[model samples]
Target: MPPSPTPTGPRIKSPETLIAESGADLEGHGLKRTMGLFQLVCFGVGAIVGTGIFVGLSDTVAEAGPAVIVSFVLAAITCVFTAFSFAELGGAIPVSGSSYSFAYAALGERVAFLVGWCLLLEYGISVSAVAVGWSQYLNELLDSVFGVQLPTALSAGPADGGVINLPAVVVMAMAAALLVRGIRESARATAFMAVLKIGILLAFCAIAFSAFQEGNLTPFLKEGAGGITSGASLAFFSYIGFDAVTTAGEEVKNPRRNIPLAIMICIGLVTLLYCAVAVAAIGALGADAVGDKPAALSLVVDQVTDSTVGGGIVAFGAVVAIASVVLAVMYGQTRILMSMSRDGLIPRVFERVSPKTSTPVRGTLIVASVFAVPAAFSSLDVVVNLTTIGTLATMVVVNIAVVALRRSRPDLKRSFRVPLYPLSPVLGVGFCMYLIWGTGWTTWVQFAVFLVVGALVYAFYGRRNSRLGAAQAQAA
Candidate 1:
C-alpha cells in the first residue's frame, strides 16, 4: 500500500515564525505601516470599481436582461465566500503577497509559485485592460468637455482599427511613477481618485433612480440559467479588487482585527453600489440597450436623460475609476512579484528595492513595461477575458486552501474563521468553477497555454530556487 500522504504544510503560519518575520518593529527596510482601514477600503474600492463597471456591466446586461440584477447578487455571494476565506487566511498569515503568500505558508512552495504566476495574468493583464478602457472614457470626456478628440490611431486598439492606445500607455506610465515614489503617496493619490469615482457613481445612482421606470424590468429572467451564469461570470470582474485589502496585510495595523473587517466592509459597500447602479441602469434604459457597446453606462445615461451631462459624468467617473484600478492592480502585481522574487521563485531583479523610495522600484518598472506594451496594442476584450480566468482560478485555490488548512492544522488560531466552514469554502470553489466553466473554450485554451508555460518555468527554475527548498536544505 502507498504511504499516506504527509500533510503539505501549516495552513497557518506558526506564531513564532510570524512574529520573527513580520513583527511591529521596523527591520531597517524603510517600510512603514501607514495604511489604516479607511485607506485600505479606499484601495479596495478603487480597485474594484473600474473598467468592469465602465465596460463589462453592459455585457452582463446584454446576457441576462434585467435579471442581471440577480447576476450581480449571485456574483457577490460567490465573492463573499472567498472573501471570508481570504479574511481568515490573510489575517492568519498577515503577509503582503495575499493568496500567493497564503498558499505558500499553507499548501507548499510549488502551489505558491503557480499562484504567483497566475497573478501575472490577473493583476498585470487586468491593469492593462483597465488602462485601455480608461483611455476610451478619457477620450469621450475630452471630446464632450473640450470638443477635441485623439486621433483614432492613438486612442484605440488594433482590433478597433487603431495602431496603438497612446492615452492608456500614458495613464499607466503616470501611475507607475507614483507607485515608484512610495506607498503613502500612492495611497493618497488613490484616495483622491476613489472619492471622485464614488461620488460620480452616487450621482449616477441618484439621477438614474429619479428616472427609474418599473416597466423596463418586465422581461426579467428573459435569458434563463445559462444567461444568468454568463452574466454572473461577467459581473465577477467587478469584484476583483476587494482582495486588495488582503494584499495590504503587512502594512495594516492590528491586521487580525482590521483585515477581515476591511475586506467585509469593502465587499458590502461595493456590492451595494453595483446593485443600485445595475437596477437604475436597467430600470431607465432596459437590458437590451446596455450591451450595445463599450461605453454602455455612458450610453444609458445619455439615453435616459436626453442630455450629454449624464453620459459625460459617467464617462468622467470611468476615467477616474479606471485610473485608480490601474494604479492599485499594478501596485499589487509588483508587490507579489517582489515577494516571489524574495522567495526565489522568480528572478532576483524584482526583489531589489530602491534606497531612495524604499519601494520595489525594479519590479514596478518590469510590471509597467509588461502592462504598457499590452495596453498600447492589445484589445480590451482579450485582456479582460484572460484576467477573469486567472482571478477565478486563483480564488478557487484560496477556497480549497481554507478547507485544507482547517483539516491540516486544527490547532492554528484564526482571528477570522470562515463562516459555515467546509460548506462556505465548498460553495466558493463550486462558484469559481462554475464561472471558469462559463469563460468558454477560447479562454480555456488561453488559460491552458498559460498553465503550461507556468509549469515549465517552475520545473526549470522555481523548484531549485524556492526559499522553502533552501530552508529544508539548510535543515538537512
Candidate 2:
C-alpha cells in the first residue's frame, strides 16, 4: 500500500493533515468564493451540453437505434455514480483541481500526480476535439448567414484532406481570451451561450415532435444488447464535464452545501435533456435518417420548416455553445495544473494567479496554445479515444478516493456522502472500468503509453520536488 505521503519519510501529510488545510478560503492566493449554486450549475451545463448533443449523438444513434434512449440512461447512470463521489469530495474540499485534489488528500502524492497527468488528455485533448466540432458548426452558421462555406482544405484536419482547421484554432484562441478575463466573466459568457443553446434545443424538439412518427421506434433494439452497450460506452463521453461543476475554483460560496447540490442538479438536468432530445430526434427523423445527418437537430428543424431560419438558429447556438465547452474545459485544465503546481509536483508558474483577474494567466495561455496547435493542424480522432480513457480512469480514481476517505477519515464532517456507501463507489469503479474495457485493446495501449510517459515525468521531477515529499524527507 502507498504511504500517507512518502513511503520512506516521517514528514507525511495524512488524510487528516491535508483535510486540516482544506476549506473554501483562498483569498491569500486571490481566488474568491463568489459563485452560487446556480452559477455552478450553469458552469456544469455549459461544460457538458455542447459537442456531445450537437455532434456525438448521430454516431451514438447509429449504434443503438431507437434504443439510444436506453443507452443515454445507461451512460447517465455511470456518470451518476461518479457525480456522487465528486459531490462528496467537492463538498469536503471545496476547492478546484477536481479528482486530482481529491486523490491527493485521500490517496497521496503519487496517485494524485497520475490523476492530473491523465486529466491532461481529458481536458487538453477534449478541448481540441470540441474546437474542431465548433469549427464545423461555425461553418454551418456562416453558410446559413452568408451563403458561403470555408474551403474544404481550411475546414478539416489532414485526415479529412484539409490543410488546416483555421476556424477551430481561431475559436480556441477566442475562448482563451475570454477565460483569461477571469472565471466570473467566462461563467457569464458560458451561461449566456448555454441559454441560447437550450433555447435552440427546445425549439428543435418542439418542431421535431410535430413530425414524430411511432414507426421510427420499431425494432428499438435492432442492434440488441451489444449495440446498446456500445452506444452507451460512446454516449458516456457526453457527460464528461459535470465534474467541472466541482472544479469551479475556490470561488464558490457555501461550497460544502452548494457543490453537492450543483453537481446533482447539473447531472440530473443534462440527463433529462439528453433523453428528451434523443427521443425527439429519433421520432422526428427515423433512426436511420438521424444517423445519416451531420447536424441531426439542425436538420430536424430544417425539415419542419422550409425556411432555413430554424436550422440557422440551431447552428448559431451550436457554434457558441461549443465555444463555451472550450472555455470550461480549458478552465478545468489550468486549475488542475495550478493545484498540482502548488503541491510542487509541477512548475510554480502555473500556480500564480493574477491579482487583477484572479486567473491562472500563464497556465491558461499554455493550455490554449498546446490544444489550439494540435486542433489546427492534426486529426484528433485518435486522441479523442485518449480523452475517453482518461476521463474513465480519473472517475475510477475518484471512486476509490471516495471509498478510501470514507474508511480512513470517518471523523471528518462531510456535507455530502455517497449513498449506498461502499456499493456506490464500488459500482462507480466497476461501471467505468467496464466502459474503458469496451474502448478496445488499441486504446488501452495508447492509454498505457501516456501513463508511462507521465510516470517518467513524475519520477524525474515530482517525486524529488514535491512539497509533501520534501516534508516527509525532512522528518525522516
Candidate 3:
C-alpha cells in the first residue's frame, strides 16, 4: 500500500487554549454574561416549544394515529441521551460556538468548520420554517378576531401557490430587530413569551382532555412500527432547540453550572408537556379528524366546543410561541457565526460586537436578511425535513465530541458529566443515527450536497485562513 501524504499544519486546538482565548475575548469584545439559570431554561423552552407542537401535530397524527404519543416519547428519549452529552461539553468548554467549539478543541479544525456549517442549516432554516408556521396561525387569529385574513398571495409562500409569504418575512424582521437590541433584552422577552406559551399549552390540554374519549384511542398504531419510527423522525424536529441553551455559554452567568442544569430542566419540562399535549389532542378527537389540518390545535377547539373563543385563544398563543422561536433561534445562529468568524473560518464581519448593544448587530441583520428570502419563498415540508436532518447531523458530532474529549482531555474542569460515561454518549449517537435513517432519501441527498459545499468552502477558504493554522506555521 502507498504511504499516506504527510504535509499538514495545526489540527487539534487544546481545551486549555480554547478556555484561555474565550476568557480573553470576554475581557475584550465578547458578549456580556446577562443570563441567569431561569432565563437560560426559559430560552431553551421558548426555542423548543414552537411550530412543531402548534402546527406539526396534524402531520404526525396522519403518520401514527394515536401512536403519535409514542412518537413523542421516542423522540424525547433520543433528546435526553444527547442532552447529557451536550451538558458535559457545554460545561467543560463553555464557549459561544457550542458543538463547533467542542469539535475544534477535540476533533480538529476541519471537523469544527463542518460542524459550524451544519449549524447554519439547523438554526437559520429552522427560523424560516417556524415563521412559515406562524403565518398559518396568524391567518387563523385574524379570521377569528377581525373576521378577515390576508389573501393567499400575501400569507403563503410561492411553493404554496402564493405571490409571497408577507407575514413570514414580517416576523423574521421583528426577531432581527429584537436581537440587535441586546442579549439581555432578548432574554427577558423570551422569558415572558416562554411563560405565556406554557400557560397557553396547559390550557389547551385541559380543554382537550375534557372532550377525551377512550374510543378515540383504539387501534393506536395506525401504520404499525413503521409509522412510529417515521413519526418519531418528524417529532425529532420538536427537540431541535434544546441545545440552543449551550450557544449562550459566553453570555450566561456561571455557565459551567447553569448551562448543564438548564439543558436537563428544559428537556424534562418540554418532554412532559409534549407528551401531555399529544395525548390530549388524540384523545379529544380521533386521529382522522386531526390529521392534515392547518391550524390544527385551534381547529380542534373550535369543533369540540362549537365556539371560536377557544380557537382564538390557541391561535393567538401560536403567534406568540412561534415568534419567540424565531427570536431565540436567530440569537443562537448569530452567536455560532461569531465564534466561527473569530477563528477565521468565515468572514470577520460576524464577530464584530456592537459596543452600544452588546450583540453582533451586523451578523443579526445579515442573517435575518439572508434567511428571510426562504421564509418568503420556500416549501415548508422541504425546509422542515432539511433542518431536522441537519440538526441531527450536528448532534451526532456533539455526542462523538463528548467521547473524544473525555479520552483526550481528562483534566478539563467539568461541572457536569454524562452519568453513564461512554454508554450515554454511545446511545446518543445510536439514537441520532436511527432518526437520520428514518428520514426520506431526498433529504439525505440534500444534506449530502450541503456537506460537499461546506468541504469546498473549507478547502478554498477555511483551511488557508484559519488563525490556528497560521499561528502553527509561524511557530514552525
TM-score, per-candidate, Cα-based:
0.94, 0.95, 0.97
After superposition, the stretches of candidate 1 with alpha carbons farther than 4 Å from their true spots are: 1-19, 22-30
- Cα lDDT, all candidates: 0.83, 0.83, 0.89
Between prediction 1 and prediction 3, the one with superior lDDT is 3
- TM-score winner: 3
**RMSD, every candidate, angstroms:** 3.3, 2.5, 3.2
Better of 2 and 3 by TM-score: 3
The reply for model 3, stretches above 4 Å from the true place, is 1-10, 24-27
Write candidate 3's Cα lDDT for 296-387 as tens digits: 89987888889998999999999999999999999999989988888889998988888788888999999999999999988678688888
Q: Rank the candidates by TM-score, best first.
A: 3, 2, 1
Q: Write the per-residue lDDT of candidate 1 for residues 112-221, one digit (tens) a residue.
A: 77888899888988888888889989988887677788999999889889999999999999999999999999999888998998898888888787878898897787
Q: Would you give me the overall lDDT of model 3?
A: 0.89
After aligning candidate 3 to the native by TM-score, how far in Å is the CA of 362 from where it should be?
0.4
Which pairs clash in the backbone of model 3? none
> Going through the candidates in order, what is the number of backbone clashes in each?
0, 2, 0
Minimum summed lDDT over a 10-residue window in model 1 is located at: 1-10
Query: Which run of 10 residues does model 2 get worst, by summed lDDT?
Result: 18-27
